[model samples]
Target: MRISLALLFAVVLQLPAENGYAQRTHVAISMNNVSVEQILNKIEETSDYVFFYNDKTIQKNRIVSVRNKSGKILDILDDIFKGTDITYTVVDKQIILSTNKMQLVQQEGQIQVKGVVKDAGGDPLIGVNVKVKDSTVGTITDINGNFSLQAKKGDVLEVSYVGYATKTVRVQNAQVLNIVLTEDTEVLNEVVVTALGIKKEAKSLSYNVQQVSNDEITRIADANFVNNLNGKVAGVTINSSSAGVGGSSRVVMRGTKSLNGNNNALYVVDGIPMSDMSAASTQPTDSYEGAGQSGDPISGLNPEDIESISVLSGPSAAALYGSAAANGVVMITTKKGREGRTSVSISNNTTFSAPLVLPEFQNTYGQTEVGSYYSWGSKLNTPSSYDPKDFFQTGVNVTNAASLSTGTDKNQTYLSLGTTNANGIIHNNDYERYNVTVRNVAKMLKDKLTLDLSFMLSSVKEQNMTSQGLYYNPLVPLYLFPAGDDFSKVQAYQRYDSERNLLTQYWPYSTSLALQNPYWITEHIKIPNHKNRYMATASAKYDFADWINVTARAKMDRNNERRERMYDAGTNTLFASKYGYYSKSNIENQQIYGELLLNINKYFVDNTLNLTANVGANFENNDYQSDYFGGKLKSVANLFTFGNVDTSEKNLANQYGYHLKKRAIFGSAQIGYKSMAYLDVTARNDWSSTFKGTNTGSFFYPSIGLSGIITDIFRCSTDIMPYMKVRVSYSEVGNSPDVFLAIPTYALVDGV
Candidate 1:
């Protein structure tokens, strides 16, 4: 156990790959009956090479046939254009394609264009893509960020690099150019997503916050994306359920905070809180009965649609969210459209799962007597051949996902679809899910008013999710089977009883554990679950001025679930009668959230001081309902239905629901001095329906923090420490009492 935890921590602390492009990498291509344009795009997808060609000069419709495996780029290019007028030139990782016939016409106005690309910090950027706006004339920056290309005067130059914003400029008669590209804040490591999806500099924050990029989350795919976060974040613990694939995961930050209340961290998606719509967790009380796990609402979100995740492990970092974030917060930012060329990405991932370790079993021992449950017997000349591990099988998980992003400066859209089909190591344990998402952003009113809208749909089906308990768990009987018996005979786990005229369990052994054939438990006793959900969101922000703006947002999420458990005839008397047992439940949950914010930013004392503030009001309503019915069968031996429930026996019928509402007003202020130090303060007051009819229903919480840059305060050399800061904060948070704790309630007897 200690070794496992140490390994987990090691992975979380490792640094991510900072550089994406590698020079002189081998290329592989195999294609027949495809267009030249298709081949060019394929090369770009498989390697770091980008192809630039003029639509008029190159024959994009020409059919091409080529097969190369790990061959040099120059060799493959020579083979591809040997007999045609097409010519290719390789400059670093960029490929320029053109026809010899166009060179004669180009000499009329073509001139040598020379330029250097640098970052905002004056550092030269290598491998930056530089191209003419509408032609194939382009080249990549070589060592020292210098590039030379052929272009005419007045032609536009486009400069682009990963993690930096793209820039364009029109060339003049002068043949020299110097371009500086600024880093995109959205992709910067120093930028953090704060409460209400506000962007802030990490150095200015006074609390602990960790950001996990989308690449890191999807590095190791799982049915539930949360499982991929197990060893990726500091101060957070993620544990997958024992219920096999697509099961719920417990995510806790800073350890358990309450003895009776929920310790799980709150999940916020795109600035809206997501409700916990998972089934109630179950535990074996006396080893006679236990239930399987149901997937959580957060798992329904497609991982391919996520852009990033931020972890707020301390109360000071989540105080703006009021009582809901008392434990901690996990903020999920989804992908959105961007201004650029239309792009499509598709990926397929397959992974297998198996038991990491198994207990050693003795094959020399034999059962003391016939039909014995334990292998406490004398040694045998011929060792038993029974092996419990044979009951386990390799699990398979496959996921296919695709996404499309495109738009102009005025409007952008993003669409994605994903599907997962998986089976657990235990037989009859399986899970399948499908997801679709659409998002769009538009600018209107002279770029002052911005509108954003998104929608999502998800469907899931799961069966026989295995749990780590004695009851209904195949592992129990498989491991406890007596070695002396003929285990192969029990492979046929069911048989027709002549007297009862119905199928019955085949196992003849009986003991205190009430063990049945392992195969019978997996094939006969069953549990199935299904869920469908949809969410919609819309928001509008208008820039009244450069330093002030007002925004309004609203979202609705609805989920429906159906779960069932069925036991075949001749099962254990503790859970089922001679007839049979069946249980069914239907649950519906919904959450509606709306918010309005007033944002302000100003500079004071000739830019010596800066102040940023936000005042907001928000409301949320949650409605939940569930219906359940279950009982043992009456006269019909194998028929399982509500009408066939035995009237003389104690049956189960339940109907319960809850409606909770919360409203809050919040404000935050940040004051900065010369970009060196900052002071932050926030306050929120919440009114809850759980405490209705009492003044105590209203509660307030506030937090204050201060941070200062060490290098700036002491005037130390930045070369030794480019960024260093010390911070301290104090905060107070309130946890809303469980619903109905302050209200009167009654107990029901015999379903009255």
Candidate 2:
């Protein structure tokens, strides 16, 4: 009968292709009130299903009301497991849930691993951490040093960081890892940081703290990086200021403990406290026709946003920062935000300077009086071509910087921008600056709280700023020209005076009027200086255990300055007066600070004694103001205003204001033994509203320290004497009495 009817049509097409995953795939459902794990994620989003269970055996937060418009997802999971003793099994596309009928499996020695964490010069070492050994399971490498975790193979990971050296491996099957570490050179030669930002260790430090780093302050790009720390610390001196390219530098650490107070130093950045108060022409007296050293306040920072620069050189390493460390303490440490994955850095610096010496002048003399400023005249036939190196000019310094760092692993960020332009071998003498910095770091609860916020902005503009003695200094008329004149014929210093309708001075030698007309005192004897600064900081830390911690910080630093000088009316009569001489001044400085710290770290005999403690409190407020009006220009020319000047009394206008408040309470303690002998102590108390009620208005500072490790007490041989330590300390810091000394002040006479 036709071959048995084709064998019953091939057994009915192989019986629905072997059961089609035990049938029942169609699934269309409508949800309401969700949860039964959202109806098993809406029946595994409508089809090829996948549900598994035992997140504590089903009951995925119950609550399910479903309507199956087209179902066969086992009839909507049998109306979502009817009386709910939960139980399901589909296997082929997975839907093996369980509750009473138990059957859910998936958990066999987890395994996901992945890694990277370099540093023995191979770079990449962002936050490190990487746990897994001993449980709480961890993670931290991002920002390029990658990482991911889930341990299994044989477990045991534990990488760490902070000066490195702390690693362990073993995760056999290897899903990817690369650690490197190494460099705990004895914990980086015994830590450091000190004075309030407190970190101690060099055998418990008893004084001499140095440390520079940030690759020694950007190696050698100095626009006043505290003059690059002169000889690199050892009593730290510095000096620097001939007013070239944004001047003012004066460090002085151990030697100058304040004779008349403020011997520089004291400029802590990250831990706040800043204000090298300068700008009173940076005080080096003998005013050469006015306004010179207007640079300080650490010459507007920005050493690529630093990252280290300690130097608490004395007062036993700055007796807890009281009285602004009394003349010791440079601190600094900026650049934060690391936990990685977003980074960009760019830098450029170009420098070319001249005149390393220049000052042996004597073009064989010439000019015994022909409009002479005496180069002692006479004997000059060929030597009088007069070349003080043709009056200098070949200084160029450019700097550009950019930075951005990104993070994750609980937030992080850091940004930076910098620009600088200089030129000064004197010809218009310029210097410009702009910088911006921002920082943010966050790590909430689980990380035990940590927050840091920062902002800094700076702008500076300078031009023709050089005032140190001879009338608005143009190197005092280019070194008293007249070696035989012809300095390129006055470089056209100005000429247009149909009888004083404007522009005059064309050089004719005046000598003692402090020589002017060095190209008309750099074109019109002007001096423009501008400064704008703002700093803000906020900090928070909270550990609450694991040896306790608590930190709180607040900071605000503000600055505004404007200084101007313009002398016109035929210049140099000790700075133009025939109705032309103008001066403008406005200086403002503000500081607000707040601190609270409490830190402790314990460990006893078993760990062989170790203590470490710190308690702090601080509050500071400072405000300074200066305003001045200038004289003479009641109209003889460049009409600069104080409303055109000329306010009598020989016209000298001035005003000043200052306010200060300081409060403190500090403490510190350190003890160590097995870590190789040490002891330290600190205490501070200060009050001063410049001595509010006498008895020196409250001051008490103390510091004590002792250390020993003469080759770890002779157990020596760190591969043939690696380090030997010894220290001793004693300190008592203090300094107060300056602004209006003890109040009762007066001066402003005529203006009154």
Candidate 3:
């Protein structure tokens, strides 16, 4: 008996310590306001263990707060489930979770749910997020705002949309749901994207900034989206050139600041500055002799790629951009991949356009004489059958775009492709464009280091682009055609010239040099423009501490543009030389920018006073080169190649090149008092290569602003007025001269 008792005691003593539980591993965790599922995920990630439990049996939605220093798994679980009626058991490499009162049993059935989301006004809300609460099953509303998901009964459905309040509806055995969301005006008015891609509370900003959402910018399509902003924003004016499709647009904010230089606002995309260069044009003494206006750089951007646009309309709001923002700044923010399940979206749009109004012409009078250009001739009993309306055709534009976004907790990816095909109001004039964009985001080192990389490729081709001059513009002859003339007679504008053995203009008039056969000009004269662009951006951010961080970003944007002008023989003699004229021009522009930023945010006085500061340095370089070959064609009558031009010194070609560099150091600081009042101060110093002398090359700018929330300070009812704030700012900004302005150069005379 004694020996048996001794054997039992020895075996019990030999068992594993901690009641047969093995000492697996220990972990250090500190989490606040986390969920039970998140805690288990962290544990699973840190150890070689898997968690097993019925999702329906576990209360994953319960909030948990825990802190442990090198604690064992069991001890951490105990701390996590201290007051809850839950328990866990570890066997082998799995942790089985069950309620304290009973064992967990997994459910095998799921309900299928379908729903349509709409706004309070009953308008379908596309892209609304519909998710089963606390699960990985989610979907977005399609173009028609309809969604479907597989969720069990009693599972909550969380629906959310931008600028709308979130709502959670419990599934009550209903197969279909029609949910309507209310607008959240406070959230819409509270956030604003500032200069340098910084987001801030609107009420705390010292200067005024206006925001335009993607919905507003994409509500209607235009060849030049910048024209859509006309009359939409205060203190801003937009002017679109008469050049047909893909024309240049001028945007002036506040007022003009430069007397001789460009007054157009600077454009920034995703925190990187973009070139706003426009193609050069010859100013004609009269409207009929100059080259057509070329498309602006901004016109090449796709509106579908934009997420939002913020207009810093005043110097105070654009102080950080230094000399480049003397006329204010237009900051563009693009969409990024979200942290959720994969989603794909596709959209198509078609637009029809026509002339809004046309000039009135006298049709009661015939030409003064048979072939005279004057319209003050004797009255005609039969009005002229010529109508200007017959010269213009209805324009059609079609655009298609698709985007895909997918991401995990630590990585995200986004890809987009779009195409635009459009026809102008004039015959034989059309434009086509293609664009592709890719972006990837990665988080490493426990989310302390973040990396973002993006690339964009775009191409634009314009056929028979209408120019301002009468040489290539069909409008010149279409509008000036004699009222008494039979318009259909000129439809076949080319006739065989027996002497030249070639097709020649069939016009009967010779008075005005600008007037020509419209059909002849449209078919014989060719002006084709092509532009290709590539942009790449890489940015990395490292959070060294909770209150301090640093970011380094670099970007390169390059584009090549080619334009050709060909004039066939027998065209207007004044516009084209003997045999014919052909000109080819190639322009290349490149911009490289790099920035390093230090950001700091700290709290004082028990979080009543919050302060934020940003110190950054930027380096930017721009290079532009243009090569032109222009002369009268030699030998070849219809060839449009540069090699066919006469190579003599009298018909020489010219080239031009310009290079500029800009460096800037900027700093900004903001202070807020209990989210009620705020003060902001910013300073920037720029060194421009365009300025020659040491002192003249550098400029300094500063801005200060103050804002106060009267409603918050006075304890007013928000129901009466959602928000009320007053702000005022003052700034001193400088404008740098145009490229090569400060340098001395001589033009080539006869190819000297």
Candidate 4:
């Protein structure tokens, strides 16, 4: 028949890989209806031809004797593995048995599937279309929706796509799956999670990573989850401390990377590495008015134990993290181990936060005004209901939670416990805080051992209300103080200097006879604070083969602090003690980390290789201590006196510090050459004792990158914009600090 149609058109043309795309081949047959000469004698009873290709595979396994008509069954198994190096791929009616020999092999007894395809309020449903039923096997999913398929024995699976309803799975014995897909309100897609955790397809990322999940930080837990990420990211900026809600918030992710340290970033969690310091958040803007400053140590964490948050802005999106990431990096992912069928979740939502930005102040004058009224004209007292409705504005809140999850297929677990309480709107200027948190995740030795544990406890108490200190302090008596003198009779009559441009005094509150005593400085001042904290991490990973893997990590973070400043013994004028004064402070910090890692993965299927390799070694240690004391006492009977016959002149301070950082050498590499070409290389080295001499020591940082997937090498591969990729990266991190060698040179003094 015309030489069997010219050898099936020379085995349907083929080529692609050295940085392009296509490289497919196929040959599979396991039928209940075999013809075409019993599928060419079943590929000549399993390979090894020779001998005139075994009589042309037994005279072409007859279809009425080698097609007494034409040809099919894939042109007779493409002339039996055509060019003999054996390779394959066919995504409809399954068949992928590649072998060009660049190994990363794993195959075990058919029936397999590992899934992820979300929708119904859980968002994530890409390309969906997986099949098994009615022949023509299938597969499609990637871009975070992940997928892996292979089935046999009682197949019967059919999951359609293109929108809502279509599912029919019955392979019986399941294996790791998670699919939700619901909303197709006429196709609407938007999903992104690039750089490393690879889950692209959010229009194929060009440069932008800003995902904040976990229900938008539990609906902005009363601000301070990094201040609810202020105005949501565009050029990010947030500076706080106008005395509001637990005070202190200043995060600038993409600007001012450093003019003198304090420029921030690098705060990973779960993938471990948290604690970027200059003692994180310095608070101190008058603890939101009344009560010695405090608030902003990760704002006592607990945003439902976060689930995912990425903010790796600059340094080329954190050049594989080096040099403390140079003011950029905040990757955090927590919450796991779940396979379902044992779920218990209880959540509580609460809201009551006052102050959506307000600070205008000047309600038609209250604590006195208009000739400084007490009796107008010259200067004097203040009262008249000290009105303006006593400057009104208030706020309050409370929340609670609990969780539990379970799974099977060789185990899965997640446990959670939580609590929160808050109050603030200024009056007795109240603030009360108490919190407890616990998180656990386990996946037994079957999924290859994994366990993560988290625990937290917190406490806060505050008080503020002793009235009077108004009409904007210029020295007492702002308006009506003569008629029934409110806020303690008026003192030093209205003294006015209005910027003492130094000279004159129409004293209505201030003109310098020092009209002090704003209700005796908020009645007997008092400031108190106390805190304790701990954070941890422990790890172990082992695969040892199948592309190798080994890991070991241990981490710890600790904090303890105490502060008190109280004074009361009469000082209506610089000195008039009934006897009382105080100041005390103590602080401590500790951090430690250890690590070891190695990973490698390889797969090529003919010059469309994709490789990954990583190595690690790390050790870190830090400790700091501080103490201060101040005194003076006589009698309120000595508010717990501290004296050597007290009279004022009490000062004491102590500080201790230590740090040891060590990092061994390691090399990392990633190469791709097909599947849209790419290459990435990395190297690391460090040893610091805070650096000293020859202007710094032990350093080495290397990086290189390039990517180009351009629509899978352009002849356009799609199914709703599959992937795009186009990357360029360069890296060279640095940080050698002796902090300007802690200055103190001029060694010539040795001549003594």
The TM-score values for the models, in the order shown, are 0.74, 0.32, 0.78, 0.31
Question: Model 1 segments beyond 4 Å from truth?
Answer: 1-188, 278-288, 360-386, 482-486, 693-695, 717-721
Two-way lDDT contest, 3 vs 4, winner:
3
lDDT of each: 0.79, 0.73, 0.77, 0.52
TM-score, candidate 2, is 0.32
> By descending lDDT, how would the candidates be arranged?
1, 3, 2, 4
For model 1, residues 720-747, the per-residue Cα lDDT tens digits are 6755689999999968877777887897
Candidate 3 C-alpha lDDT tens digits along 355-406: 9988888889998777766788889999876778877889998988899988
Between candidates 1 and 4, the one scoring higher on lDDT is 1
Per-residue lDDT tens digits for candidate 4, residues 1-752, read 10122222232232223102212222344444334445544443443210112112233333332221222334445555465443443323223333445111333324455466766644456556677888876776543465556665467667655445667766643244577755344432345443333333333233446767777678856534677777766666776554445554666777885686666566666655655445424533233233334445566566676776777675545555567665666676766546546778787766675545433323233434432333423333442344322333456656566767766544556666655555555433444455555555555653456555665565555444222233222223332233333443333323434453221212234324334344333334455566666776676667643346676767787777676656454433232243556666677776787777676655445224656677777776767665766655554433644452244443333344445465555566766664356676777777666665456567777767667768757757688876557787777776556333544454333236
Give the best candidate by TM-score.
3
| Candidate 3 whole-model C-alpha lDDT, 0 to 1 | 0.77
Residue 89 of model 4 has an lDDT of 34
lDDT tens digits, residues 83-109, model 2? Answer: 878755443464454555323323454
After TM-score superposition, the amount by which residue 385's alpha carbon in candidate 4 deviates from its true location, in angstroms, is 5.6
